[model samples]
Target: MTELTERIERLAIQDGTIITAYHALSFVRSSDVSEPVPAVYKPSLCVIAQGAKQVLLGPESYFYDPGSYLVASVHLPITGQVIDASPEKPYLSLQLQFEMDQILDIIQQPYFTENTGHKSHRALVIGQMSNSLHEAILRLIRLLDTPEDLPALAPYAVREILYRMLQTEQGNTIRNFALLGSRAQRIVPVIEQINREYTEPMRVDNLAKAAGMSTSSFFSCFKEVTAMTPLQYQKRLRLTEARRLLLATMSDATSVAYQVGYESATQFNREYARLFGQPPIRDVRRFLGMNPQ
Candidate 1:
């Protein structure tokens, strides 16, 4: 634990998600309690080395600290807040983004054996961090200091971490993520399509056909994996991107609405207020500290 803390502290010199030489590994440090921040959580492994945090996915709230880590296997729109932190202790964490192809590579390995079948759930899972995994993470972080060693050794360290993850209880989720023709695997393409085309009109039949599943089956499977219906999932994606554009560009409400696939400004205002607790303009102002109320 001391080694992990020291290494993370050394690596996380700044107060946000700091990208490393290894694109898959990043570090996070926050010094204060955070307001509810909505984000699209990509598939990744997040480990907390200090403090704690809570992530709200749809209606579900997940909490994790140093003892546990969070694994998000799919893209999810979520509200994340640092529930436990202060100036002195702060919140320190790291995230490793894994690609589906990497998982497939592991699956194809001759020695790898599938273990523990898991039912579809919210695409997110919390699992305890074992000492072995922790040591692997430490080694990966240590490689940051040796630039020449990184290109040769980092991949093996990352692979070792993934292999260790396979030995954990949530391994099945990881397996299903890469297994060809599996229900979970089938939904991956649909997620990618929706993310790429969230601004366009979407039909369940079209999406289901794209996934090679019947309408009813697609609806059920999508809900099982994402914890939301197809429409709801698309809406979340749209709304999340809308919020981003609003904050980043400060574009007008109506334009941002259409930009994110909403045809009616009135409808956009209504839904934006519902999801963000305020209209677009006011939300932006509040976020920017121009209008505190």
Candidate 2:
């Protein structure tokens, strides 16, 4: 626990990006009850040290407290809030990103093998953090203490961390994605296409063609991987972005609706209230502490 704290603090100094450590990495300052914010988790692992967080992956929800980590093998649109955090003992967390190329290399290693049967058919998963994986993470963070070593050693440490992850019991849960032609592997292209064209109206036939699957096959596979229909996934993405624009830019409700692809402002406001428990203006105002009319 103390090691986790020391590692994050040390690594933070060397990290120039808003991200304190690496491309697929982020740190929490530790907080209590964070103001709800809108965003999505890409292909990354989320680890918590003190409190808990709830991640909505489509209709299903997942929660990970201390001693646990959530790995998103693919970039899935999600809604996350640090439902638990406080200044006294803010929920501390570290997020590590995973990429297909790197995971492929790891999967190719002869010494490291995998069994697909146990691997999650779903893209996102929660695994208990083991001492080996946690300690490896601590070591990577410790590298921040020696600045010169970071350039030469950080990459190696990152790989080793990936190796440790591959060795875990549920390691197979995440390793399957990197292996080419797996069903989960096939879902990648479709997910990418939706991510890029999320703002546009989707054509099921075109998307299914792009995914190289019959419409029926595509629908089944997409729903299996994401637990939602394609359009449902798009709706979540749109609403998440609408919330972001309103919160960040103080954009008006009608404008936010249009920007997010809603055809009618009235429909947008109705859906926003249903999804977020309030109309766009009210939700944004409460989140940003702005005066309400």
Candidate 3:
């Protein structure tokens, strides 16, 4: 942990998330506990170098610290908060986003063999931080100090980290996310479509057709992989986007609500408060430290 912590601390010189030269990689540092931030997580490997955090996927709560890492193989709406941090020792973490094609390419390698009998599960998984994985992450972060080395060597380092992940206990679960014709694999398209079209009205039957499953089977399997129904999934996405818009710009709640596919400002205000523990305007203000709710 010393090596990982030292490297991340040196690179993360600020108190917010930073996207590095490696396009798929990002680093986070926060000096204090953060508000429960709502967002959609991409398919990525997330490692905490110091402190602890909690990630909410639907109703489930996942706690991880330096000893464990979290992986989200499918894009899903999640609420995350830094549960443990202080001015003396801030929360430090890294995220490496990967695409489905990359996972498929790796699985097709001759050295890799498919695990036929491994059953599929939810997209969000908590995995042990193996020694090799920790070392790989440290090496990846060390590249930040050398700008020239990044263009030539960063890909290899990133690929090595992915290889290490493939050898971990959660490898099969990650592999199943991209494996063709698998139940979870079949649902990937639906998830992507929901993310792309969250602002549009969605019909479950249409989504079921996209996944090539009947409505009942699609509904069941969707919940099995995402832990939320189709409508619930869309609502999460909408609310998360609304929160983002509110923070990023000066958009008011009603306009942001309409932009995120809400038909009624009354319903939007009601659900936003329920999910965020405050009204949209107050939540944003509390997050920005301008006002305390």
Which candidate leads in lDDT?
Answer: 3
User: Tens-digit lDDT track for model 3 on 1-293?
Assistant: 88777777787898999898788899899999987888889999999989999999998999999999999999989999999999899999999998878888888899986544344579998888889998888788888888789989988888888878877878899988888999999999999989999889999999999999999999999998999999999999999889889999969899999999999999999999999898999988988888655
1-293, model 1: which lDDT tens digit per residue?
77777777877776788888888888888988798988888888899999899998877889999999898887888888987877788788999988888788997899998877464555888888888888888889889998789999999999988888877778888778788999988998899889888899999999999999999999999988888898988898888899999899988889999989999999989998999999888989998999545
Q: Cα lDDT for residue 163, model 1? A: 84
Model 1: residues with Cα > 4 Å off, grouped in runs: 117-121
lDDT of 3 at 28: 95
Alpha-carbon RMSD, each predicted model: 1.5, 2.8, 1.8
- How far in Å is the alpha carbon of 265 misplaced in model 3? 0.8
Best candidate per TM-score, number? Answer: 1
lDDT of each: 0.86, 0.77, 0.89
- Of candidate 3, the 10-residue stretch with the lowest lDDT total is 112-121
After TM-score superposition, the amount by which residue 234's alpha carbon in candidate 2 deviates from its true location, in angstroms, is 0.7
lDDT by residue (tens digit), candidate 2, 74-189: 87877776877665656677888877788889878888766443567788888778898888888777776676787788888888888877776667867877778777777887
Clashing residue pairs in candidate 3 are none
Scored against the true structure, residue 249 in model 2 reaches a CA lDDT of 93
